[model samples]
Target: MKTNTTTVNGIDTQALLGAIEAIRNNPAEAQSKWHVTSHWKGGTRSETKVKSSQLGNQTIAKDFTIGIDEPLELCGTNQFANPQEYLMAALNACMIVGYTALTALEGIELEELRIETEGEIDIQGFLGLDPSVKPGYDHLRYTVHLKGDGTPEQFERIHRTVMATSPNYFNVANAVPLKSKLVLESPATV
Candidate 1:
Protein backbone atom coordinates (compact mmCIF):
# COMPACT_ATOMS: atom_id res chain seq x y z
CA MET A 1 0.00 0.00 0.00
CA LYS A 2 1.08 3.50 -0.76
CA THR A 3 1.66 5.82 2.18
CA ASN A 4 -0.25 9.08 2.34
CA THR A 5 1.00 12.55 3.30
CA THR A 6 -1.12 15.54 4.10
CA THR A 7 -0.82 18.68 6.16
CA VAL A 8 -3.36 20.46 8.39
CA ASN A 9 -4.84 23.95 7.96
CA GLY A 10 -3.20 24.25 4.56
CA ILE A 11 0.26 23.86 6.06
CA ASP A 12 2.86 22.80 3.55
CA THR A 13 4.43 19.39 3.93
CA GLN A 14 7.89 20.77 3.28
CA ALA A 15 7.46 23.32 6.04
CA LEU A 16 6.25 20.71 8.50
CA LEU A 17 9.05 18.33 7.59
CA GLY A 18 11.65 21.10 7.91
CA ALA A 19 10.29 22.18 11.27
CA ILE A 20 10.34 18.61 12.60
CA GLU A 21 13.84 18.01 11.31
CA ALA A 22 15.10 21.25 12.85
CA ILE A 23 13.65 20.32 16.23
CA ARG A 24 15.12 16.86 16.08
CA ASN A 25 18.54 18.22 15.17
CA ASN A 26 18.46 21.15 17.60
CA PRO A 27 16.17 20.14 20.44
CA ALA A 28 17.63 22.69 22.82
CA GLU A 29 16.46 25.53 20.61
CA ALA A 30 12.95 24.12 20.25
CA GLN A 31 10.20 26.30 21.68
CA SER A 32 8.29 23.53 23.45
CA LYS A 33 9.16 22.31 26.96
CA TRP A 34 8.36 19.07 28.75
CA HIS A 35 9.03 18.28 32.40
CA VAL A 36 7.64 15.23 34.19
CA THR A 37 8.78 12.54 36.60
CA SER A 38 7.54 9.09 37.54
CA HIS A 39 8.36 6.92 40.55
CA TRP A 40 7.50 3.27 41.10
CA LYS A 41 7.80 0.91 44.05
CA GLY A 42 7.62 -2.83 44.65
CA GLY A 43 8.27 -5.84 42.47
CA THR A 44 6.01 -8.80 41.49
CA ARG A 45 2.34 -8.33 42.47
CA SER A 46 2.16 -7.95 46.26
CA GLU A 47 2.32 -4.21 45.67
CA THR A 48 2.90 -2.29 42.47
CA LYS A 49 2.95 1.44 42.90
CA VAL A 50 3.31 4.32 40.43
CA LYS A 51 3.09 8.09 40.69
CA SER A 52 3.66 10.84 38.14
CA SER A 53 3.93 14.57 38.53
CA GLN A 54 3.92 17.27 35.88
CA LEU A 55 4.94 20.89 36.01
CA GLY A 56 1.98 23.17 35.46
CA ASN A 57 -0.67 25.24 37.19
CA GLN A 58 -3.04 22.27 37.34
CA THR A 59 -0.75 19.68 38.86
CA ILE A 60 -2.06 16.19 39.56
CA ALA A 61 -0.85 12.92 41.00
CA LYS A 62 -2.41 9.48 40.97
CA ASP A 63 -1.43 6.02 42.13
CA PHE A 64 -2.13 2.51 40.88
CA THR A 65 -1.77 -0.53 43.13
CA ILE A 66 -2.00 -4.05 41.73
CA GLY A 67 -3.12 -6.92 43.86
CA ILE A 68 -1.26 -10.23 43.91
CA ASP A 69 -4.09 -12.51 42.83
CA GLU A 70 -6.05 -10.41 40.34
CA PRO A 71 -7.42 -12.12 37.26
CA LEU A 72 -5.19 -11.61 34.23
CA GLU A 73 -7.23 -13.57 31.74
CA LEU A 74 -7.75 -10.61 29.40
CA CYS A 75 -5.72 -7.49 30.15
CA GLY A 76 -6.99 -7.40 33.73
CA THR A 77 -5.60 -7.78 37.24
CA ASN A 78 -4.82 -11.49 37.43
CA GLN A 79 -3.19 -11.77 34.02
CA PHE A 80 -1.17 -8.61 34.34
CA ALA A 81 1.42 -8.71 31.63
CA ASN A 82 4.97 -8.48 32.91
CA PRO A 83 6.53 -5.06 32.12
CA GLN A 84 5.93 -4.84 28.37
CA GLU A 85 2.20 -4.45 28.80
CA TYR A 86 2.80 -1.57 31.14
CA LEU A 87 4.93 0.08 28.49
CA MET A 88 2.20 -0.38 25.89
CA ALA A 89 -0.38 1.05 28.26
CA ALA A 90 1.79 4.10 28.81
CA LEU A 91 2.06 4.65 25.08
CA ASN A 92 -1.65 4.27 24.57
CA ALA A 93 -2.52 6.63 27.36
CA CYS A 94 -0.02 9.22 26.20
CA MET A 95 -1.26 9.09 22.63
CA ILE A 96 -4.88 9.53 23.68
CA VAL A 97 -4.05 12.58 25.76
CA GLY A 98 -1.76 14.03 23.17
CA TYR A 99 -4.35 13.70 20.44
CA THR A 100 -7.09 15.11 22.63
CA ALA A 101 -5.02 18.16 23.48
CA LEU A 102 -4.10 18.76 19.87
CA THR A 103 -7.70 18.58 18.73
CA ALA A 104 -8.91 20.83 21.50
CA LEU A 105 -6.25 23.34 20.63
CA GLU A 106 -7.43 23.23 17.03
CA GLY A 107 -10.93 24.09 18.17
CA ILE A 108 -12.30 20.66 17.39
CA GLU A 109 -14.94 19.26 19.68
CA LEU A 110 -14.67 15.57 20.39
CA GLU A 111 -17.46 13.67 22.11
CA GLU A 112 -15.47 10.53 22.84
CA LEU A 113 -12.13 8.90 22.26
CA ARG A 114 -10.77 5.43 22.86
CA ILE A 115 -7.55 3.63 22.06
CA GLU A 116 -6.87 -0.09 22.11
CA THR A 117 -3.30 -1.32 22.05
CA GLU A 118 -1.79 -4.79 21.75
CA GLY A 119 1.78 -5.98 21.81
CA GLU A 120 3.17 -9.37 20.84
CA ILE A 121 5.96 -10.73 22.98
CA ASP A 122 8.25 -13.72 22.70
CA ILE A 123 8.93 -15.46 26.01
CA GLN A 124 11.37 -18.06 24.77
CA GLY A 125 14.38 -15.90 25.53
CA PHE A 126 13.24 -14.98 29.03
CA LEU A 127 12.30 -18.57 29.79
CA GLY A 128 15.62 -19.86 28.42
CA LEU A 129 13.76 -21.82 25.82
CA ASP A 130 15.56 -20.12 22.95
CA PRO A 131 19.05 -18.71 23.26
CA SER A 132 18.92 -16.54 20.16
CA VAL A 133 15.61 -14.78 20.75
CA LYS A 134 15.20 -11.49 22.55
CA PRO A 135 12.81 -10.95 25.44
CA GLY A 136 10.68 -8.08 24.14
CA TYR A 137 7.68 -7.24 22.06
CA ASP A 138 8.17 -8.02 18.39
CA HIS A 139 5.13 -6.13 17.16
CA LEU A 140 2.68 -3.55 18.50
CA ARG A 141 -0.55 -2.24 17.08
CA TYR A 142 -3.20 0.21 18.21
CA THR A 143 -6.63 1.39 17.04
CA VAL A 144 -8.00 4.84 17.66
CA HIS A 145 -11.70 5.62 18.03
CA LEU A 146 -12.45 9.28 17.62
CA LYS A 147 -15.88 10.95 17.53
CA GLY A 148 -15.83 14.28 15.78
CA ASP A 149 -16.82 16.15 12.65
CA GLY A 150 -13.72 16.40 10.53
CA THR A 151 -12.42 15.27 7.22
CA PRO A 152 -10.08 12.31 6.89
CA GLU A 153 -7.34 14.82 6.24
CA GLN A 154 -7.94 16.47 9.57
CA PHE A 155 -7.83 13.17 11.41
CA GLU A 156 -4.59 12.26 9.66
CA ARG A 157 -3.02 15.52 10.69
CA ILE A 158 -4.11 15.01 14.28
CA HIS A 159 -2.73 11.49 14.26
CA ARG A 160 0.64 12.65 12.98
CA THR A 161 0.81 15.40 15.56
CA VAL A 162 0.13 12.97 18.39
CA MET A 163 2.68 10.45 17.12
CA ALA A 164 5.32 13.12 16.68
CA THR A 165 4.83 14.91 19.97
CA SER A 166 3.90 12.28 22.54
CA PRO A 167 6.86 11.51 24.82
CA ASN A 168 6.00 7.89 25.50
CA TYR A 169 5.24 7.26 21.84
CA PHE A 170 8.55 8.75 20.81
CA ASN A 171 10.41 6.78 23.44
CA VAL A 172 9.05 3.54 22.07
CA ALA A 173 9.29 4.37 18.37
CA ASN A 174 12.66 6.16 18.28
CA ALA A 175 16.16 5.30 19.42
CA VAL A 176 16.90 7.19 22.63
CA PRO A 177 20.42 7.16 24.08
CA LEU A 178 20.25 5.92 27.68
CA LYS A 179 22.78 5.30 30.43
CA SER A 180 22.60 3.47 33.73
CA LYS A 181 24.56 3.74 36.98
CA LEU A 182 24.80 1.46 40.00
CA VAL A 183 25.43 2.72 43.56
CA LEU A 184 26.48 0.64 46.53
CA GLU A 185 26.51 1.79 50.15
CA SER A 186 28.00 -0.04 53.13
CA PRO A 187 28.93 0.72 56.73
CA ALA A 188 32.60 1.39 57.38
CA THR A 189 34.43 -0.90 59.86
CA VAL A 190 35.80 1.01 62.81
Candidate 2:
Protein backbone atom coordinates (compact mmCIF):
# COMPACT_ATOMS: atom_id res chain seq x y z
CA MET A 1 0.00 0.00 0.00
CA LYS A 2 1.11 3.53 -0.77
CA THR A 3 1.62 5.92 2.16
CA ASN A 4 -0.33 9.15 2.16
CA THR A 5 1.83 12.26 2.36
CA THR A 6 0.87 15.82 3.25
CA THR A 7 2.43 19.03 4.48
CA VAL A 8 1.24 20.88 7.55
CA ASN A 9 2.77 24.13 8.68
CA GLY A 10 5.79 23.46 6.44
CA ILE A 11 6.52 20.08 8.02
CA ASP A 12 6.29 16.91 5.98
CA THR A 13 3.76 14.57 7.50
CA GLN A 14 5.30 11.63 5.68
CA ALA A 15 8.66 12.28 7.36
CA LEU A 16 7.07 12.14 10.77
CA LEU A 17 5.22 9.01 9.80
CA GLY A 18 8.46 7.45 8.63
CA ALA A 19 10.05 8.30 11.96
CA ILE A 20 7.17 6.69 13.77
CA GLU A 21 7.68 3.58 11.68
CA ALA A 22 11.40 3.52 12.45
CA ILE A 23 10.78 3.89 16.16
CA ARG A 24 8.20 1.17 16.07
CA ASN A 25 10.54 -1.13 14.21
CA ASN A 26 13.17 -0.70 16.91
CA PRO A 27 11.97 1.04 20.00
CA ALA A 28 15.49 1.44 21.32
CA GLU A 29 16.23 3.77 18.40
CA ALA A 30 13.81 6.27 19.85
CA GLN A 31 16.02 6.90 22.87
CA SER A 32 18.62 9.60 22.26
CA LYS A 33 21.57 11.09 24.15
CA TRP A 34 22.96 14.56 23.64
CA HIS A 35 26.30 16.04 24.68
CA VAL A 36 27.76 19.54 24.72
CA THR A 37 31.12 20.75 25.96
CA SER A 38 32.15 24.22 27.08
CA HIS A 39 35.40 26.07 27.56
CA TRP A 40 35.63 29.04 29.90
CA LYS A 41 37.10 32.21 28.46
CA GLY A 42 37.80 35.05 30.86
CA GLY A 43 35.65 37.32 32.99
CA THR A 44 32.44 35.29 33.08
CA ARG A 45 32.60 34.33 29.43
CA SER A 46 32.60 30.89 27.86
CA GLU A 47 32.20 29.08 24.55
CA THR A 48 30.15 25.96 24.21
CA LYS A 49 30.44 23.58 21.26
CA VAL A 50 28.38 20.66 20.04
CA LYS A 51 29.89 18.25 17.56
CA SER A 52 28.02 15.00 17.82
CA SER A 53 25.45 13.04 19.79
CA GLN A 54 24.64 9.39 20.30
CA LEU A 55 21.54 8.23 18.43
CA GLY A 56 20.96 4.66 19.45
CA ASN A 57 23.71 2.66 17.72
CA GLN A 58 24.83 5.61 15.61
CA THR A 59 26.39 8.98 16.17
CA ILE A 60 25.60 12.14 14.23
CA ALA A 61 27.95 15.09 13.89
CA LYS A 62 27.19 18.76 13.49
CA ASP A 63 28.91 22.10 13.84
CA PHE A 64 27.34 24.39 16.42
CA THR A 65 28.76 26.79 18.96
CA ILE A 66 27.61 29.52 21.31
CA GLY A 67 29.50 32.26 23.07
CA ILE A 68 28.22 33.20 26.51
CA ASP A 69 28.90 36.21 28.67
CA GLU A 70 27.34 38.50 31.20
CA PRO A 71 26.40 42.16 30.77
CA LEU A 72 28.70 45.03 31.66
CA GLU A 73 26.76 45.72 34.82
CA LEU A 74 27.53 42.16 35.85
CA CYS A 75 31.28 42.68 35.35
CA GLY A 76 31.35 41.18 31.86
CA THR A 77 32.27 42.59 28.46
CA ASN A 78 28.71 42.23 27.15
CA GLN A 79 30.13 40.45 24.14
CA PHE A 80 27.44 37.81 23.89
CA ALA A 81 24.31 36.38 25.51
CA ASN A 82 24.58 35.70 29.21
CA PRO A 83 23.95 32.33 30.75
CA GLN A 84 20.58 33.39 32.08
CA GLU A 85 19.53 34.76 28.72
CA TYR A 86 20.57 31.50 27.13
CA LEU A 87 18.48 29.69 29.69
CA MET A 88 15.44 31.69 28.64
CA ALA A 89 16.29 31.23 24.98
CA ALA A 90 16.55 27.50 25.47
CA LEU A 91 13.10 27.38 27.00
CA ASN A 92 11.51 29.52 24.29
CA ALA A 93 13.25 27.72 21.46
CA CYS A 94 12.32 24.30 22.75
CA MET A 95 8.72 25.39 23.09
CA ILE A 96 8.72 26.64 19.53
CA VAL A 97 9.92 23.27 18.26
CA GLY A 98 7.46 21.36 20.38
CA TYR A 99 4.53 23.59 19.47
CA THR A 100 5.21 23.53 15.77
CA ALA A 101 5.78 19.79 15.59
CA LEU A 102 2.81 18.97 17.74
CA THR A 103 0.52 21.27 15.81
CA ALA A 104 1.66 19.81 12.52
CA LEU A 105 1.27 16.28 13.80
CA GLU A 106 -2.29 17.15 14.74
CA GLY A 107 -2.89 18.48 11.18
CA ILE A 108 -3.22 22.07 12.32
CA GLU A 109 -2.25 24.84 9.94
CA LEU A 110 -0.37 27.74 11.50
CA GLU A 111 -0.04 31.25 10.12
CA GLU A 112 2.18 32.73 12.80
CA LEU A 113 3.76 31.69 16.05
CA ARG A 114 5.79 33.94 18.28
CA ILE A 115 7.10 33.48 21.81
CA GLU A 116 8.51 36.04 24.21
CA THR A 117 10.01 35.18 27.55
CA GLU A 118 11.61 37.07 30.42
CA GLY A 119 13.01 36.18 33.79
CA GLU A 120 13.46 38.16 37.00
CA ILE A 121 16.58 37.65 39.05
CA ASP A 122 18.00 39.40 42.06
CA ILE A 123 21.72 40.11 41.70
CA GLN A 124 22.15 40.40 45.43
CA GLY A 125 22.40 36.63 45.70
CA PHE A 126 25.25 36.32 43.22
CA LEU A 127 27.04 39.41 44.53
CA GLY A 128 26.73 38.43 48.16
CA LEU A 129 24.71 41.50 48.99
CA ASP A 130 22.19 39.42 50.97
CA PRO A 131 22.66 35.91 52.22
CA SER A 132 19.00 35.02 52.01
CA VAL A 133 18.53 35.88 48.34
CA LYS A 134 18.55 33.00 45.87
CA PRO A 135 21.00 33.16 42.97
CA GLY A 136 18.54 32.44 40.17
CA TYR A 137 15.46 33.66 38.47
CA ASP A 138 12.78 34.36 41.05
CA HIS A 139 10.10 34.28 38.37
CA LEU A 140 9.87 33.75 34.64
CA ARG A 141 7.08 34.71 32.30
CA TYR A 142 6.33 33.88 28.68
CA THR A 143 3.72 35.06 26.21
CA VAL A 144 2.97 33.09 23.08
CA HIS A 145 1.09 34.74 20.23
CA LEU A 146 -0.36 32.22 17.84
CA LYS A 147 -2.39 32.65 14.68
CA GLY A 148 -3.65 29.51 13.04
CA ASP A 149 -6.60 27.74 11.50
CA GLY A 150 -7.07 25.50 14.51
CA THR A 151 -9.74 26.17 17.09
CA PRO A 152 -9.03 27.68 20.48
CA GLU A 153 -9.59 24.30 22.08
CA GLN A 154 -7.04 22.70 19.80
CA PHE A 155 -4.57 25.45 20.59
CA GLU A 156 -5.15 24.88 24.27
CA ARG A 157 -4.47 21.19 23.80
CA ILE A 158 -1.27 21.98 21.93
CA HIS A 159 -0.26 24.37 24.71
CA ARG A 160 -0.70 21.68 27.31
CA THR A 161 1.27 19.18 25.22
CA VAL A 162 4.12 21.63 24.73
CA MET A 163 4.31 22.35 28.43
CA ALA A 164 4.40 18.66 29.27
CA THR A 165 6.89 17.56 26.58
CA SER A 166 9.22 20.50 25.91
CA PRO A 167 12.58 19.48 27.32
CA ASN A 168 13.76 22.92 28.33
CA TYR A 169 10.38 23.70 29.86
CA PHE A 170 10.64 20.57 31.95
CA ASN A 171 14.19 21.53 32.90
CA VAL A 172 13.21 24.97 34.14
CA ALA A 173 9.83 24.10 35.62
CA ASN A 174 11.17 21.43 37.94
CA ALA A 175 14.15 21.12 40.22
CA VAL A 176 16.52 18.77 38.38
CA PRO A 177 19.41 17.13 40.15
CA LEU A 178 22.86 18.48 39.38
CA LYS A 179 26.07 16.68 40.18
CA SER A 180 29.26 18.68 39.89
CA LYS A 181 32.84 17.51 40.20
CA LEU A 182 35.78 19.89 40.39
CA VAL A 183 38.95 18.65 38.77
CA LEU A 184 42.04 20.64 39.63
CA GLU A 185 44.07 21.35 36.53
CA SER A 186 47.74 20.57 36.43
CA PRO A 187 50.21 23.03 34.93
CA ALA A 188 49.90 23.32 31.16
CA THR A 189 52.77 21.85 29.18
CA VAL A 190 54.44 23.94 26.49
Candidate 3:
Protein backbone atom coordinates (compact mmCIF):
# COMPACT_ATOMS: atom_id res chain seq x y z
CA MET A 1 0.00 0.00 0.00
CA LYS A 2 1.14 3.55 -0.79
CA THR A 3 0.10 6.83 0.85
CA ASN A 4 -0.34 9.97 -1.17
CA THR A 5 2.10 12.77 -0.36
CA THR A 6 0.62 16.20 0.21
CA THR A 7 1.78 19.80 0.63
CA VAL A 8 2.01 21.46 3.99
CA ASN A 9 1.88 25.25 4.45
CA GLY A 10 2.38 25.78 0.76
CA ILE A 11 5.48 23.58 0.80
CA ASP A 12 5.68 20.56 -1.44
CA THR A 13 6.83 17.74 0.82
CA GLN A 14 7.64 15.31 -1.95
CA ALA A 15 9.64 17.91 -3.84
CA LEU A 16 11.41 18.84 -0.65
CA LEU A 17 12.31 15.26 0.00
CA GLY A 18 13.48 14.86 -3.55
CA ALA A 19 15.61 17.99 -3.25
CA ILE A 20 17.10 16.73 0.00
CA GLU A 21 17.91 13.46 -1.61
CA ALA A 22 19.44 15.21 -4.56
CA ILE A 23 21.53 17.40 -2.28
CA ARG A 24 22.67 14.39 -0.34
CA ASN A 25 23.67 12.77 -3.59
CA ASN A 26 25.31 15.87 -5.06
CA PRO A 27 25.90 18.87 -2.78
CA ALA A 28 26.54 21.21 -5.71
CA GLU A 29 22.84 21.04 -6.61
CA ALA A 30 21.94 22.73 -3.34
CA GLN A 31 23.36 26.08 -4.28
CA SER A 32 20.64 28.58 -5.25
CA LYS A 33 20.73 32.05 -6.79
CA TRP A 34 18.35 34.97 -6.24
CA HIS A 35 18.07 38.52 -7.52
CA VAL A 36 15.97 41.59 -6.69
CA THR A 37 15.91 45.23 -7.80
CA SER A 38 14.56 48.36 -6.15
CA HIS A 39 13.79 51.84 -7.44
CA TRP A 40 13.42 54.84 -5.19
CA LYS A 41 10.05 56.51 -5.77
CA GLY A 42 10.38 59.75 -3.73
CA GLY A 43 9.91 60.76 -0.10
CA THR A 44 11.51 57.75 1.56
CA ARG A 45 9.44 55.34 -0.50
CA SER A 46 10.77 52.67 -2.83
CA GLU A 47 9.46 49.77 -4.88
CA THR A 48 11.40 46.53 -4.88
CA LYS A 49 10.69 43.85 -7.45
CA VAL A 50 11.64 40.23 -7.20
CA LYS A 51 13.62 39.62 -10.33
CA SER A 52 14.59 36.09 -11.29
CA SER A 53 16.57 33.00 -10.43
CA GLN A 54 18.57 30.45 -12.33
CA LEU A 55 17.25 27.08 -11.20
CA GLY A 56 18.89 24.22 -13.06
CA ASN A 57 18.46 25.07 -16.73
CA GLN A 58 15.42 27.30 -16.27
CA THR A 59 15.37 31.02 -15.51
CA ILE A 60 12.33 31.64 -13.36
CA ALA A 61 11.14 35.19 -12.80
CA LYS A 62 8.97 36.31 -9.90
CA ASP A 63 6.01 38.54 -10.59
CA PHE A 64 5.76 40.06 -7.15
CA THR A 65 6.84 43.53 -6.01
CA ILE A 66 6.98 45.10 -2.55
CA GLY A 67 6.50 48.76 -1.65
CA ILE A 68 8.47 50.24 1.23
CA ASP A 69 7.89 53.46 3.12
CA GLU A 70 8.18 54.92 6.57
CA PRO A 71 5.56 56.42 8.86
CA LEU A 72 4.52 60.04 8.44
CA GLU A 73 6.52 61.02 11.49
CA LEU A 74 9.63 59.56 9.85
CA CYS A 75 9.30 61.86 6.82
CA GLY A 76 7.26 59.37 4.84
CA THR A 77 3.58 59.08 3.89
CA ASN A 78 3.09 55.80 5.82
CA GLN A 79 1.97 54.19 2.59
CA PHE A 80 3.73 50.92 3.36
CA ALA A 81 6.13 49.16 5.66
CA ASN A 82 9.47 50.70 6.55
CA PRO A 83 12.77 49.07 5.62
CA GLN A 84 13.59 48.21 9.21
CA GLU A 85 10.20 46.58 9.56
CA TYR A 86 10.95 44.61 6.44
CA LEU A 87 14.22 43.47 8.01
CA MET A 88 12.39 42.17 11.05
CA ALA A 89 9.83 40.53 8.80
CA ALA A 90 12.54 38.82 6.78
CA LEU A 91 14.12 37.45 9.92
CA ASN A 92 10.85 36.08 11.21
CA ALA A 93 9.81 34.68 7.85
CA CYS A 94 13.17 32.95 7.37
CA MET A 95 12.85 31.32 10.78
CA ILE A 96 9.32 30.26 9.96
CA VAL A 97 10.54 28.65 6.77
CA GLY A 98 13.31 26.88 8.64
CA TYR A 99 10.94 25.59 11.30
CA THR A 100 8.43 24.44 8.73
CA ALA A 101 10.98 22.79 6.47
CA LEU A 102 12.94 21.12 9.26
CA THR A 103 9.81 19.79 10.94
CA ALA A 104 8.64 18.31 7.67
CA LEU A 105 12.09 16.87 7.06
CA GLU A 106 12.07 15.29 10.52
CA GLY A 107 8.51 14.01 10.06
CA ILE A 108 7.27 16.12 12.96
CA GLU A 109 3.84 17.43 12.21
CA LEU A 110 3.30 20.91 13.53
CA GLU A 111 -0.05 22.06 14.88
CA GLU A 112 1.03 25.69 15.20
CA LEU A 113 4.09 27.90 14.83
CA ARG A 114 4.40 31.63 15.33
CA ILE A 115 7.39 33.95 15.09
CA GLU A 116 7.61 37.55 16.28
CA THR A 117 10.54 39.96 16.11
CA GLU A 118 11.18 43.37 17.63
CA GLY A 119 14.03 45.84 17.58
CA GLU A 120 14.84 49.08 19.34
CA ILE A 121 16.14 52.01 17.37
CA ASP A 122 17.13 55.45 18.53
CA ILE A 123 15.81 58.23 16.32
CA GLN A 124 18.42 60.70 17.48
CA GLY A 125 20.90 59.32 15.01
CA PHE A 126 18.44 59.13 12.15
CA LEU A 127 17.37 62.72 12.71
CA GLY A 128 20.99 63.77 13.00
CA LEU A 129 20.40 65.07 16.49
CA ASP A 130 23.25 63.00 17.96
CA PRO A 131 26.29 62.12 15.98
CA SER A 132 27.36 59.49 18.49
CA VAL A 133 24.17 57.49 18.29
CA LYS A 134 23.73 54.76 15.74
CA PRO A 135 21.02 55.08 13.12
CA GLY A 136 20.20 51.34 13.14
CA TYR A 137 18.74 49.00 15.65
CA ASP A 138 21.12 48.43 18.55
CA HIS A 139 19.32 45.35 19.76
CA LEU A 140 16.77 42.96 18.31
CA ARG A 141 14.52 40.38 19.96
CA TYR A 142 12.62 37.47 18.52
CA THR A 143 10.27 34.85 19.96
CA VAL A 144 9.03 31.63 18.50
CA HIS A 145 5.91 30.05 19.96
CA LEU A 146 5.33 26.52 18.74
CA LYS A 147 2.83 23.86 19.68
CA GLY A 148 3.55 20.58 17.95
CA ASP A 149 3.40 16.84 18.50
CA GLY A 150 7.02 16.82 19.68
CA THR A 151 8.43 16.76 23.19
CA PRO A 152 10.25 19.66 24.85
CA GLU A 153 13.66 18.17 24.05
CA GLN A 154 12.68 17.76 20.43
CA PHE A 155 11.42 21.32 20.30
CA GLU A 156 14.70 22.50 21.82
CA ARG A 157 16.63 20.69 19.14
CA ILE A 158 14.44 22.26 16.47
CA HIS A 159 15.07 25.70 17.96
CA ARG A 160 18.82 25.11 17.87
CA THR A 161 18.66 23.87 14.30
CA VAL A 162 16.66 26.89 13.21
CA MET A 163 19.07 29.26 14.90
CA ALA A 164 22.07 27.58 13.36
CA THR A 165 20.73 27.08 9.86
CA SER A 166 18.38 29.99 9.14
CA PRO A 167 20.02 32.25 6.60
CA ASN A 168 18.43 35.53 7.57
CA TYR A 169 19.02 34.78 11.24
CA PHE A 170 22.69 34.17 10.54
CA ASN A 171 22.88 37.30 8.42
CA VAL A 172 21.37 39.51 11.11
CA ALA A 173 23.63 38.06 13.77
CA ASN A 174 26.76 38.50 11.63
CA ALA A 175 28.14 41.66 10.10
CA VAL A 176 28.22 41.75 6.32
CA PRO A 177 30.29 44.20 4.36
CA LEU A 178 28.45 46.64 2.11
CA LYS A 179 30.02 47.93 -1.12
CA SER A 180 28.36 50.96 -2.69
CA LYS A 181 29.18 53.58 -5.28
CA LEU A 182 27.16 56.70 -6.05
CA VAL A 183 26.30 57.26 -9.70
CA LEU A 184 24.89 60.68 -10.52
CA GLU A 185 22.18 60.86 -13.19
CA SER A 186 21.49 63.92 -15.34
CA PRO A 187 18.02 65.35 -15.79
CA ALA A 188 16.10 64.19 -18.87
CA THR A 189 16.25 66.38 -21.96
CA VAL A 190 12.50 66.00 -22.49
Leading candidate by lDDT: 2
Candidate 3, residues 70-175, lDDT tens digits: the string is 9998899999999999999999999999999877666667889998888889999888999999998878988899987778888899899999999899989999
lDDT per residue for candidate 1 within 116-159, as digits (tens), equals: 88877676876778978887767688999988766678889999
On a 0 to 1 TM-score scale, where does candidate 2 land against the true structure?
0.91
List ranges where model 1 is wrong by over 4 Å: 1-43, 46-82, 184-190
C-alpha lDDT (0 to 100) for residue 33 of candidate 1: 36
Candidate 2 C-alpha lDDT tens digits along 82-190: 9888998989999998888888888888889999998777889988889999988877999999998889999999999999989899999999999999999999999
Extract clashing residue pairs from model 3. none
* CA lDDT of every candidate: 0.65, 0.88, 0.86
- Candidate 3 is scored at a TM of 0.89
* Candidate 1 residue-wise lDDT at 1: 18
Model 2 ranges with Cα > 4 A deviation: 1-5
Off by over 4 Å in 3: 1-10
TM-score, one value per model: 0.61, 0.91, 0.89
